[model samples]
Target: MSDIPLEHVHREPDSDTGNAVFVLHGRGADEQDLLPVADRLPGDRHIVSFRAPDRLRGGYTWYDLDLSGGGLESSQPDPDGFRRSLDMVAESIDAAVDAYDLDSDSLGLLGFSQGAITSLSLVLERPDTFAWVAAHHGYLAESHADRSPDGIEGKPVFVAAGAADQIIPASRSEAAAEGMREAGADVTFGTFEGGHGIGPDELEAVQAFVEEHD
Candidate 1:
């Protein structure tokens, strides 16, 4: 769209209900990376996936990871880059709302790894902006600490983690759930037996969650 600066690819719903599920890919991936994942989700809503602005390796990254000390497991998001990506994503969503005639109240989010962290940060500070969220193999970042669990009570959120994940440990995802639960979000935290990537079980569970809420 002319008003939207972010590069995105969308899949139209079979039947539009003015609803949408915005899918965010992990670092080193682009909008197209998550289209298959979105297709598997059960919803009669538009699917949108966006490319992160910063290019790295052979793909895109939402923010840089500072792995100087404890490495990827304990690394933190670069404040400046994270903030910029956040603002740009917000702008994209606003433009999408106007361009697609979407119902803002029916918007949901699905993300993986770095994308999950970004998604969680976005919704945590502004819970009312989205209806539900599903984060896979990702955790909550310490940078954006504006969590108001009370204001987000009864909100549905599904959190999936890999028991053997090395990149962003399962413990981090558990902690993310704890934080969201405090925020009064109806969280579904699931730990599958695997590594950093989403597995079949995780996909099935997430699909079920989206279906239940849809």
Candidate 2:
């Protein structure tokens, strides 16, 4: 769908373990933003982090935002733009698996904020693509919430929300967790004391989820 190529940073594990993890960065962040977290996660899994295609301000964004009314909300995402980016991410994952000769069965996704939104949407849209998912400080976009939940049944999902998050309120995050649970996913949901950001506790939980699922 999208003709634009996906740009990324790939890190190979010390040994070939036939597994891989893909990292998706928050809004206004680049591919390198999540590289450190990839290193912290357990296992010898190839790590790949993709840069969002759209440039905004000094950084990149997965989708445009509507900061109207003094709150953060996704503008009606351009359908073509969203589809193109999603297609690129899917293609990139296929390419990575093939290039690294990695096991497709063990692939995982970790994303924060807008990146987390994309991760959840992708996994919901194409549930078979990821073995597990960790979405931090993100909620399911309203546009993508009507899909059948059957595809994600039994899938492992981790949702970390910031209790004081002004950008994405806890109520929204809780709703996202409920949505995942209703989809029959084995969801692990937690909330930190901070606001709209990840911390050490969140990281530890993510590591545990990855270890348990992978």
Instruction: Tell how far residue 127 is off in model 2, in angstroms.
Output: 0.9
Model 1 stretches astray by more than 4 angstroms: none
Report, for every candidate in turn, its global Cα lDDT versus the true structure: 0.86, 0.83
Q: Write the per-residue lDDT of candidate 2 for residues 106-201, one digit (tens) a residue.
A: 999999988887888889988888999999989877668766556699899999899898888877777788888887788999998899888899
How many angstroms is residue 161 displaced in model 1 relative to the true structure, after the best TM-score fit?
Answer: 0.4
Per-candidate clashes, comma-separated? 1, 0
Could you list the CA RMSD of all candidates, in the order they appear?
Answer: 1.4, 2.6
Compose the digit string of candidate 1's lDDT tens values, residues 50-143: 8899898989999998776678898888889989988888889888878888899999989999899989888886778788999998888886
Give the number of the best model, judged by TM-score.
Answer: 1
